[model samples]
Target chain A: MLTVKHLAKSYNGTKKSLTDVSFSVSPGEVTVIIGPSGAGKTTILRSINQLIRDDDGEILFDDVDMRQLNRRQLRDARSHIGMIFQNYNLIEPLTALENVLHGCLGTKSNLAGMFSLYRNSEKTEALQLLQKVGLGDFAYQQCRNLSGGQKQRVGIARALMQHPKIILCDEPIASLDPKSTTVVMDLLRDLATNDGISVLINLHQVDIARTYADHVIGINNGQVVFDDRTAALTDTAVTDIYRKTTSSERSLVYEG
Target chain B: MIKPENQVSLPTQLPAGPRFTIPLRFRDRRRVTMLITLLILGYVTLITLPTMIPDHFKLVEAITGFTENIKIMFLQPHLSNTSWLSLLGGLGQSILLAFLTTLIGSVLAFFLALASTRRFAPTALVLGIQSFMAVIRAIPTVLWVLIYSVVFGLGANAAVIGITFHSVAYLTKVYADSMDELSPEAIETLQAMGLKRPAIICQALIPYLKPSYLSWTFIRFEINFADAVAIGAAAGAGGIGYQLFMSSSFYFDFHEVGVMVYLILAFAVVLEIISYRLRSSNTAQH
Candidate 1:
């Protein structure tokens, strides 16, 4: 379980990227955040992982405040929180197996990690995760040679390698085709249900969000405008969240 | 039916204009600029022609003599003064000097490059190391060799030191550039996975940089080989270059010069083949 309260951030001293954002993700639940572009959906996910520090917030993971931890403690805490990106972000030159095994770097000794001396047990687990993600045959294949869907599978296996309690996904399927999108979304859902891992995903596609998410949070203009269960979300409410503003409407009227 | 409001009266007489007018002089700027440039070049050549060639007949005679000498040198090569074994031995020494210098220099450069990369080191340290390498690269390789020769007394050791010094500087710049171009996404992902700085660099950065490192090292080796040949003559380092210098300057044997030139060309071609094979093999593995 994870909780974020009163999270606020501003790139400059004036304009806010996220204003008073708060949310919680329960275990084994998929919480999807949907918004138009530049609506601060990614800012919330990045803030939770401490990739981008918030000027005001308390991100409590199992009752420990991430903001209060020092550098070493922060690193230790981050091992329990996994993250996936839109780009797959797999090391291109490394094989899928090695990339998965890289998840163990945080736990291994500095010298051992530098030499890539993964224990047999860790190697076994990494291979099993690869197999679970349907990349067992491509374990030795370099990531650069993999297709987009296959690469995202490797990314999933790599995240699972951390044995994380919570996983943050930032537009994991944004670059994928419709077919690959379904596969990745289905995989994420299955992992959350079977492994009991909490997932906080930032998505732009409202239809996919409504289908997969148990809870949906809609954001607009750096504010959470809608938060409810998927069943309770109306088509009208979704439309309003993504509607173009009135200033543009007025300009159109003037041109006409 | 035609609309009454839209209808207009037509002009009876055609507009008076010249049948054939001169074309616009400055319609296209590029053509005009080129013509002006050609005019200036021709004027300059005409002004300088008399000064450049005061005696055309004497110049023609000198060129003819030079051609005759070249024909004699290549058609009839003399290999009597130096034995084949000594010439081969000198060639081997030059290659060894290049190899040793490149080996030591690349090792030093790898570490210095790691330190100089912005991803690994802080701004102040990276700037400092980069500035130092720039200074080293600014000086010519032969000048560095001459300086070392004065210190160590002319020999192969001086040549090796000089080439290594310049090689380290050259390789550092190239290696640092490749490292700088490394994608930040992989590094960010690793950091998110809780990897420490060193682990991230070793796991993510170094493996990505391996191919570029090898290619850069090979290129630097080629440069160092050329430097070795120059230093061999300048510093009195015993190599094929020294033999070539002696044949041309001391013995005045153009035929021996021809043999030395061919030997050097053969070695250079062999090195090119080796470098090409290595780079291709590396790419295939990746």
Candidate 2:
């Protein structure tokens, strides 16, 4: 479970990138945030982890405020939170399994992690996740050599390695192919449903959000305009968030 | 087909205009400026020559005598030859100083460069510090070494500090520029993945910078090595430059000076080749 209360962020003497927006997700729930470009969707996710400092707000993760935590405390608090990206930000020089192993690094002793003192259990778990992601044979392969789809899958497995209570995906499938897009979306959905991980994903694809999310939150210009159960939204209801622009380009963002 | 009428006749065509002709008729301002500058230089030299020096007749005679004596001396190689070991021995301290200082300066400069980079800087204050490093670089290494030779009590230690300080400035600029070239997308991706700042630099930025960094270091090393001689001589300390200085001051001990110059040039060339090879091998391996 996660709660963001009246969150606001202004980056470096500039206009607020995020306004007093609020949203919450229940345990094992897939909460999707859909917005046009520059809607502060990514900022919201980053703020929850305190990667981006919010000027005003409280992010309660299991009822503990993350914004108030100090450096070491924040680092420790981060183990329960896993984040992925569109770019599949694995250390390129590292192998697939070695990168997945990086997820456990926060909880493992820093000394042990630095010298690569991985436990047999952690290695087994990493290999198992790779298998679950259909990447068992590519464990030894360097991340740089992987295709976009495979890399995102490895990104998921790497996130899953944390055994996180909450997972944040900032357009994890935006750069992927249609087939790979569905596979990744389905995996996120399955994780939220089966693994009981609270997930908040930002996406441009309205159809994928509707197909996979348990709930949808629409954000526009740093504000959350709509939040509802995914099942409750009719086709017309979805249009209000995407109806401002008439160009084919605007429709492509949430065309379906 | 029997009449060969089916065979396609080559069509007459106007050739594409002037594919390889030089535009000789056109003259740009650049060419005009160059010609004017050359003419002025030639005119000034012609006017100044023969009158600039006092007693040209005696001067020419003296030069001729010096040349003949030098020629005779060179012909007898066994007479005034400086031993190879002594020449190299005098150069050792300067080379050692350059090596030590470059090692220290560059290592620190890398961190300084990282801190200075807009991408990695903790704050604006850090960026300001990187600029100050540029001021250090603007001053020549020889000048800095000369100053430090006095401030640091005039020796190879002074030479080392001076070289290190200057090398740091040069290297920081290189490092920072390379850091700037890193993809903002890559950095954002790393940060999004919850990696720490240090990890982001080590993981994403370092790999991209490795080739350029290695190349820059080798190039800088070669430069610094030559500078060692210059700074070494100037710093009131002993080096190949000091030996060269001594030989020159002693009046045309070409045999001794020649050997030292040859040795320095040879070592420098050898170092350059080794570094070039190392960089090539490193890139291939990675």
Candidate 3:
């Protein structure tokens, strides 16, 4: 389980990205965060894993405060938390398998990773994750050669390589095509069901949020406006959450 | 005047400033500056040239040392050394010195560069390491070599020490710049997956810097070839430079001197070609 309390982050000292924002993730729940741009959705997820330090907050992962953890302890804790990026941040020079092996950082010694002398046990595990993401055949291919959707699949597999308790996805499908977008969303959905892993995904699409998320949390202007089951969000409330200020106030998306 | 393309293009009228005050002369400044500099240099040389005539006169005796007819101005026709070991042995020593020094200095500079980069290290440590690197690079390699030669005593090792010291300075600068421009997103991706600083530095940064590093090392070897020539001149050490200096001092041996000059140029050109190949392959691999 993961808990974030009073989390606040700001690039400039004056402005707060997240103001007293709090959230918790159960062991097997998939929590989808929806927000307009600059609404501090990504910041909230990054802050939880201490990738970006929160100005004032406490993040507890597996009953240990993440902020209080030293470098090694933090690294250890981070291994249980995997993060995915919209850009598919795979190391370009490495093959897909090697890039996935990068997720074993907390589990491996500093010397082992530095020398790349560690056994292919983690590598084999990474390949299995790749197979789960449907990249089973392209393990040895360079990441640069992978298409956008394939790269994200690799990114997802890389995150999974950590055997993480939770996964953080920051617009993982924003830059993807429609088909690929559906694929990634479905994959995340399956990950939750099959592995019993918690996920915090940041997305802007209301329909996608409604379709894939178990529960949806909406943020507008850096504050959460909606927190409830996905089925309970009405058309009017969804528009309000999205801040689509149409003079006609017509629904932007058709709901069948 | 340009109705079609200009009208359709985005509006980008030049902003008024000191950036280009002279509109007609704004193509480039280098041409005009280079002309002025050359004129000034030429005039200075003309004025001070009489004082240098005596030095050229000394070369006349060195030129006349060859007994053969064509060898007078053509330089030494043969690599005739006073001692076979000194010539062959010195050639071997020169190569060995250049090779060893390049290896040592390049390795040391590489690690130091990695340590000093902000991207690869924490800011506090990077700043201190960066300043020290700058200080080392500030002093010319010749001075470092000269001082090191004095301290370490006059031998090939001293020359190597000097070469490595200077190599560290330049290698550090180049490696630091490369490391700074290393793909941050790439490194972060690795880190996000739980990779450490060293892993990212090696897998991501080191490979990117490889061609540049190898090119730099080859360049240093070429420089140190001439540098080794000059080093022996300073310390009366073992090298072709000592032979040239001593040979020219007693009797004018333009033939042997030409041989020395030719040898240096030949080796340097070969190394330069190899460096070019390295840069090309570096691009290919990456």
Kindly indicate the candidate among 1 and 3 with the higher lDDT.
1
Candidate 2 — which residues are off by over 4 angstroms? Answer: A8-20, A55-57, A108-128, A221-226, A245-256, B1-51, B57-80, B84-95, B120-124, B151-154, B183-208, B278-286
Rank the models by lDDT, top first. Answer: 1, 2, 3
Candidate 1 structure quality by residue, lDDT tens digits, B31-101 = 88999999999999999987887665597788998988797677777696899999999888888888999
Tens digit of lDDT per residue, candidate 2, span B77-174? Answer: 33144566766676676567667777887798799888888786766856687678878878898888878867788777777888888889888888
Clashing pairs in 2: none
Tens digit of per-residue lDDT, candidate 3, span A32-123:
88877887898888887777888887888887888898887777777778899988877766788877777776577778777776576776
Cα displacement (angstroms), candidate 2, residue B146, comes to: 2.1
Better of 1 and 2 by DockQ: 1
DockQ of each: 0.58, 0.16, 0.36
Per-residue accuracy of model 2 over A1-256 as CA lDDT, tens digit each: 7899999887764666777889998999999999888878989988988878889988999888998988777877786688888888777767899888877766665465546678899999999999999899999998888999999999899889888899999899989999999888888888988999988899999888888888999887677878999987677767767656445633443322
Model 1 pairs whose backbones collide: none
Model 3 chain A — which ten-residue stretch has the worst lDDT? A247-256
The residue-level lDDT of candidate 3 at A22 comes to 72
> What are the TM-scores, per candidate, against the unseen true structure?
0.86, 0.76, 0.82
Best candidate (score: TM-score):
1
- lDDT for model 1 comes to 0.87
